[model samples]
Target chain A: MNDFKIIDDVMPDVPPPVVGAVAEARARVFRPHRPHRLRLRFPVWAGGVVAAAATVAVIGTAVAVPLLGDGAGDRTGDGATATATALVDSPGAEEVLDAVADRLARREEPERANWRVETELIERWPFAGDEFLVENRDREVHWAGPDGPAVVEVSRVGTEPLTAADRAAWEQAGSPRLCGSDSDCENDQVPYGRTRYIPADPGDYHLSSVRLSPQELRELPQDPVELKEEILSRWARALKDIENSDTPPGGDVPSDGDAVWWVGQRLLTEAPTTPQTRAAVLRMLSTLPDVRITDGVRDIEGRAGLALTRDTGGPYAERIVVDRATGDPLAVEGMPTVPVPQLKGLPTGSAAFSKLIRRMGWTDEAPALPEGCTPRTKKDCLR
Target chain B: MITAPDEVSSITAPERFGVVFDTHYEEIRRYIGRRLDLDIAEDLAAETFLIAFRRRDRFDPARGSVRPWLYGIATNLVGRHRRAELRRYRALAKTGPPPDDDGHDQRVVDRVAAGVTVGRLSGALARLPRGERDAVLLAAYGGLTYDEIAEALGVAYGTVASRLSRARARLRDWLGVEL
Candidate 1:
């Protein structure tokens, strides 16, 4: 916490001019800052101006925008925020809803008793990071209506298979490992290694249920094409399912790699047409809404980029920062980071090669997609 | 003549921010100086006011004084630069007394202030485990209520209460400050 009492008086105010350089970079990043740098939104102003020491304090900046600014100046309190504006009726509301309703209405089939979503494997591979890393693993969504419960099968695909050493480690790990000799192993069945229940209640909307297994983890492949295909196919399907869920739950990409999926979701079955949307917008303008930019700026494979942070509401928030110049995925990252209690989850740590947090980075080209891939279902991925 | 953050006209709102910092910048600076190294404290303090301006929008009219929120922001910003903080404390532990600006009656004022140092406060503060330290500092300096502190720190409120209780228990023992 800060001690604010005498700090303000001894320090002279920072002139808007002195804050220009770094402010310019911030404006570039956050974009369209008000009342200042009104020059066509994001002008990388050339050169710098040196203001007098008396005019601007020497606290000298560091790409910092003076703390997160206040909402006191917002006149937009009366209306919906820009994001909520889309959900405003805009006369298209009835038509859009009718069309969507008509499509679902055409199904005409009776609702089933048991709702089941299947999570099949799309692909997976190794993922490396600065201090934390893990393989990119994913289980596809299984969409079976009222079919008992969700189920999945796991198998190891490494060339050496589970070595005796691997099997021993598996036992110590309470045996999520498959084909281990340990009698307590939970990996004995197919199409149903585990059947975790996720209630259909709206309250359970944000939950991502999955049986994490070491048997599912595998070392990454050296071949770029094979690895890309495996990771991307899973990535696409997983993206689709998240968009369809009520709660924006995230999970490992239905493939393998050392990547962190930082997913932030805005949950809304009903769009901003309602008055609640306006109130929500007003609240948001004062304090940032649930939406968040991921791990922010970070270096990736030696280039500037951003990682993926998805809100698994629609077609998923899954995305990579393709370099503007090269259009390649410079890195991967995601959010909705839930800091787990100590000793509750896996060891609290990061091993560069073993740790897999995703980030956005520079690229020469768009990230390669699986062959015949379709964009994740477009249900407002920004949520 | 300053009204609450809510009373300021949205139009004049942005402008007054300039004035408020101009007026209070030094007091803020000194407070930070007492807490951290002068140079680093100045930066964090400066950044604090800057952030205060940006976050002016969030200032609740219901919540009159801006002091607590500003401290909260500064705490968060300081948190991002945690290594710098620990380094300042380690250095302060060695540097002995902080540099006094007035120099007039330095010993008397410094001694008295040091006596209240929150040193026991700071020591008890320092004694707290990391999680508890965050809750106590946010409450003591930032004046954040359980909910605000929890939201600011991104933890649950129950956690805030537990940590605060634990920290206060420790501070009470050390500073002997009556709860």
Candidate 2:
């Protein structure tokens, strides 16, 4: 027998394709295939009719916080303080969201072949008694055209003590090495590692591991109820591996509501969602059983917005802070609601993890690729 | 492998591609499944068939048979996910088999031996160049002949022979196993 026969003994045993999966695969070929018409231009807002329709719809009657800003110095802060942030449940979440959705619908969006999102991610991982905060700036450019793949470039910013107390503790511990191979501290947790480009299908963009085609996203249900069902179905398919595997990567499978919230956050922030679909997602989220809205909450950037927060059934409550007037997502925060054994030094109410959305919009300019790398480079080219 | 009359007719009758899919889908899926995660394998398998169906008019039976043609398409799709495949190998090299097996008496002993062989081989496979690794897997996991692999990878027959020879030598050096 050939020595190569040993490979068969090691390969992961795959279960036979299920009936639903087989049918889904079959439909891809049998269905009438038409390439989505590549949209080069955006619709210019025909002011009077669209504005009049939105005015008749309910404007936010709940609160008095101004939403519009000059967009200068708007993006800052990691919100790593040890203060306990309280989220008071309010009935005005739907009203506020509806008004914001109406504004987003009438908002003027630029037309560009590529979209880029620059984010500053700060994560605090507590090991033993000392806590380490790792920061990385990630830039992802999604080419909306059919030919080019999405590119993601990540730079390791730095790792340091999260607080002054933690810094003092670090000094007392002889300022132990936080980086390099010798140190036990692990900072490079973001899966994309250095810089990589993923060859997604035409008109598709990636969010974490899930791929969302722009045409399909734009074609999502406008009605909130129908939209929720659609999201749930797609999410179930994405979560299949986690459900089957005894030891999933991230521990237990998320609850249905948790899964919806997770996907909805990506749709709102990462994926290129239409105004109608964004509105639908917001409305749908407001109705989720565990999700609640906290009005007048300031993000790490010191920008005040409504925090659409959901109880994660853990120490941390996942929250997405969106700009009040424009409804653009400003930041995502994982605020600790209770003290846990793992994180002894961190306070209960402070955000242990936060991703500040510095810039997210369409641009004609493509991201600066690595040396000797172009938009069409299929493999990752290291600099 | 598909020697049936209806299967042979699919080369000419493009409409009969569904018959080809029905016959080869599981086999093509298993070939990719051995290289990558099952979820990704399922997706790439479907994509291979879709591409094949679309390019059926381009099918040149004079060059090769349909089985190798399908493998070619599937291998190309696997190439797109090269990073994920490499990551899988690295993880397996460190962790041995995924803790899927129930620790029974004799089975546990078999698993330990299997895990050791897998770990040693995975480390070597992960180090091989993508071309050599692809050739090795095509012969080992895909159970394709050297000619079939050459056709599948769009390489010369001699190239396949040299790559396999080098890969086998490297595996022997790393694994210290008898070929």
Q: Let me know the DockQ for model 1.
A: 0.06
Worst lDDT 10-window in candidate 2 chain A: A44-53
Relative to the true structure, how large is the alpha-carbon lDDT of every model? 0.31, 0.55
Question: What is the interface RMSD, in angstroms, for predicted model 2?
Answer: 17.7
Query: Could you estimate the TM-score for every candidate?
Result: 0.31, 0.48
Task: Compose the digit string of candidate 2's lDDT tens values, residues A197-255.
Answer: 33332434433224466667668887777777776667556445323433212112233
Write candidate 1's Cα lDDT for A1-383 as tens digits: 33222112221222222345334322221212334312221111110000000011112432222112211111221222323322221344323333332343233323333222222211111111001111222222212122221211122222111235433443554443222111112111111232221111111111011111211211222222332333334434544543453322211121112111211111011111112221222222212222233223342223443222322221112223223232223333221122221111222221111112222111222222223322222111110
Compose the digit string of candidate 1's lDDT tens values, residues B10-115: 2122322333453455555544554455555555576566444433423332222455445555555454444455555555444433454344234345434545
TM-scores for chain B, listed for all candidates? 0.62, 0.87
How much is A144 displaced in model 1, in angstroms? 36
Q: Model 2 chain B, TM?
A: 0.87
Candidate 2's C-alpha lDDT? 0.55
Please compute DockQ, using alpha carbons, for every candidate against the native two-chain complex: 0.06, 0.09
Off by over 4 Å in 1: A1-383, B1-32, B49-67, B99-123, B138-161, B174-179
